[model samples]
Target: MPYQQHTAKKMARPTGNVRWMVVGLCFLGMVINYIDRANLGVALPGMAHDLSLTPFEQGLALSAFFYAYAAFQFFGGGLADKFGPRAMYTFSSLWWGALTAATAFASSMLSLFGVRFLLGAGEAGAYPSCATAVGRWFPKHERALATAIYDNGSRVGGALSLPLVILIVETMGWRESFIITGILGLLFAVLWIKFYRDPRLHPTLNAEELTYIEQGGARPIDPATEEKISWLSLFKFRAVWGLMLGSFSLNFIAYFFITWMPSYLINELHFSLVKVGFVGMLPPLTAVFGGLFGGWLGDHLVRRGVSLSVARKIVICIGMLAGSSIALAVFVPSGAWAMALLCLSYSGIAFCASNSGSLCLDIAPTGRHVAAIMGIQNGSANLAGIIMPVVVGLLVGNENNFSHALMLIGVFGFIGAFSFIVIVGKIAPLTRAKRVKVADAGANNEITH
Candidate 1:
């Protein structure tokens, strides 16, 4: 069957309630992704104690995942662009799931580090694939909403992890906790493979929905299409550098929260392990709302005739300005109030973050090359994921005060805001070779509508 005809037929009669199912399933994938991410953190104390690891050694082990994860984001993005997200996501889930499960068996630091590094490599494709899926399955207006929906998984997963990990670690040990979470991810992978398809590829989607998506500027990419933008050539474009530097700075803040926040809560805030789990989960919980709130606001602004550039910038600017304030909360006299302020800060960060992937697409503006741009941006951003852990380890390993670390995060947060606000301009594409598809015929339609 011709591709259009196949989609047309499916559009005439989509499968039974698949749209909602697709959303639910993708949500699960994200949930599993985060559970896998946070599991190590939950198990960190046990792992450190069991292996007799020094703080530096533990930091190295913890950072092994980011080193490989960051490096492979480019490869993952390229592969996703080449093969489509369905297969890429499915394979990533399975590979990373198995690796995570295998982490339970590590008797030595070397083995633990090896598994974490491999886990990072395996999971590298997750976000690029999510972006690819959003590009394929959603309309332009709904793009941020869809991103918010999946992005919220990080928070939900983290939230769920605290209780789940505490229970499992208390009863069965950290190994069993890893094994159980790994199995859940594996199960979700099987379900995803069975259920998901591109909108044009799905049997359940109707023509109305497909048309609506196309009307909102979804374009299909031919998987067989092959192209590459060299690092040198990509660097020549100022927009690429802007995104790269912006992502890097944002991630500096992010990695501090992700890798060190729990330690801060336990060591500085004097929270017990179980309490630390719950408290550590708070920022992420607020982040879930922040992502949704930001996405909704950004879309609403777009609907109200604000340009995508302006809308994105406004959301990011507010988020950075407000979110960075949490860093200074470390100095607050009251701990409870301090946590509340930090929560507010992370909410802004989450809201600001929901725009980065979408902004990449805006800059690309034509071809379905988001995964490629994301690869470059994420690769640079993830360097923070790797380096921040090591730096935090050095700063807090000897010094009792983590205030310096918090100060650093605040500085980077402010810097991240500045990059997005100042360096990135007008949401314009860098490549003249890539024509703006929707803009040519109806350049101001969105603005005027």
Candidate 2:
């Protein structure tokens, strides 16, 4: 069926308590998800020193989570579709938390790798489920902003992880730091189970509000319909492949900085731990503002009559180009200038991620089927997490340096930018043929239009 035209009636936005309630919960979930992951990188220097790990071995450990995470993306989405976001969210949160705490018990590389891998498997559902919730709860115009608001968790997690990890590692031990971070996740899991309700199932949701969300293009698909959409069928489409490759390329750049920046500051630039902890937050701090700004700009462009395709692709391309180019600053003589460039580069990706993920929803044939699509995209992207750490390990091993690693990432960024422009094509629903053969039950009959 064709989309019904909106008759010039603009619905009023939800006022007061309800709006705040939803945003607050989502924001907390985002924070919990990122903070747990960020702690590992922050604590890595100490963990490495204590364990006597080589750069190659350290990279292997860092990439361990992604090994399982990338594999579980599809499974996570299936679980979300089968059990609903509430159950998936609650279970994943608790499961990852438990795995994170288990890291404290590790005395060897194998133990740490095992725990991290489990953590990844448990947390695989995080972003896709969050995207599903946004699809269920927000209007189309508001999703970018809502996504940006929640995505600040990455910044917050990265920012907070530095100081918190430093403090905990200093006061207690690196092991305690892992345990503390893990326990925080457990608390969030309990809260999620208690608070989240599917919008249709919530008696408090008003008709006017439902109509507003629905009119703005939110599709309240039956929970059952989520399962009816086959994950393998979604994978067969060219667009799905585009999202997968694009997301993986983007993560190749992103996870590098996320997983390695603090160590880079210490080893390459000769920064003190105190300085690393304090100054490291500046990039993510800038990223928070960049994401918010990018979200607002992308949505504004759409409202001004630009197609969603053009708006998303332009923002993402500009951000990737800027990010990749700024990486060249590593060659400059001044360390301060290099750090500033690094900051600007990640800020660009921050902006891009804020808007780009929402494109999955915009182009998904039905909002109901978005989880599986997002799952594949996320899974493919996370494969980069596995590949990046291992590659960085190879490039920056004991005798080698970062020059080749930096160049490789720059090339990837360039390729990723081209992909959005050339390969992504228009942001519209995919067409499938409507024609089907008509058969007579008893005898052969001519079909007429």
Candidate 3:
């Protein structure tokens, strides 16, 4: 592809820092997206008390969102691929915002479950769209940083919710917190639809910036994927499955912190709601640093002449080793000391996670497929999300010992490390097949057409 020549030839372009502006917008969207989702965990504890639910039932409520969330991952990606990032993002944000508000109106366990399921389904498209958008707007070199900047929202939102949602629950009540957060998402959705577009189509994007992006390896939109690859062909590559497996390990650990950690502190450790909320802020705070450091380090390694494949894997493995701290932290008795260890554990998790989105873009065959690939990975990971909460709930079932669940989480981190090192051979785009066969329908379409 004459990427440089084509991009350089464009006359009208958007002005300075608009690419970074796009990254900034996505970052705020991520923060808002997470705060809406993460608040449910904080709210669940209170909702359980009022509803007179068992731990098992509350676990069901916790897991319900993931059911829809996991199921929609592939669908969301397809939507992003077909519709473009702007429209899909706008729709998802608006839909989830509406569902978040609907959550406040639930009167029974079934109602809450339905609302959560809908909410998860609504939000499932968000990250995949973000992944697709990043692939479009930024070059390959800056993807990790852009991903970290936005992905940091998972931690920032979680960290912010620690104080924000819990204090709202402590004061005005849990229902109102949903109403407030939902409104924020609605507002962001409007802003996003108004400002965002594919870089090739972006009216404000300048020629110099566009050329710079393409020169740095930004992928142009591809219509070729429509003929080049089939849904089954995606499975022909091992990278996709490795990503799916690794994401499962990561999400299993993440949901533990996001959905259950607050309950763990309150129920087992006997901490006050306010106290737990404040301390809960710690892990996400440290995770912010992890996201930043991981992005910069990964990018730095690539710039220093290291292979992108090796750099991503090395970064991922080191992060998992650090993340394995969860197993040891389970044994610590002191609340403050345990908080310290949890912080380290989450930082490592974020550090490793900072690369996951980049990996999705790295392997995407074209700009259009970025979200779809991400969705496959996300959906697979969230499949575990659907299972782990219930698994942990069953494991804890009226017991104070979280050691078993905690160890399971730590073990998953190691599994993820192994998958990246051994299973996912190289971080590169999926190349279309060259051999022409009667059965090679995908290639045959390209050849015959």
Candidates in order have lDDT scores of: 0.75, 0.75, 0.82
Candidate 3 residue-wise lDDT, 37-135, digit = tens: 988898988888888888889889889999999999988988888888899989999998999888888888999999999999999989988888888
Candidate 1 lDDT over 356-401, as tens digits, reads: 6577656653345677777778888888888888887887775546
- Models ranked on TM-score: 3, 2, 1
For each candidate, give its TM-score against the true structure.
Answer: 0.89, 0.91, 0.92
Model 2: per-residue Cα lDDT over 1-449, one tens digit each: 23222322355665423434665677787787777887889888889988888888889999999999999996787677556678888888898888888888988888889889999999998877777777777766666777777777777788888888899999999999989989988998899888888777766778777666667666456544333335565654555666777778778887876788888888888889999889988888888888888888887786666777788888888777766854586587977887888778878877887777776676566655667677877898899999999898898889646777877876777777776666665665443321112122211111223
Distance (Å) between predicted and true CA of 232, model 1? 6.1
Evaluate model 1: give its TM-score.
0.89
**Model 2 alpha-carbon drift over 4 Å, by segment:** 1-9, 16-20, 223-229, 434-449
Question: Which structure among the candidates has the greatest TM-score?
Answer: 3
What is the TM-score of candidate 2? 0.91
Best by lDDT: 3
When summed lDDT is taken over every stretch of 10 residues in candidate 3, the lowest stretch is 2-11
Candidates in descending lDDT order: 3, 2, 1
- Indicate whether candidate 1 or candidate 3 has the larger lDDT: 3
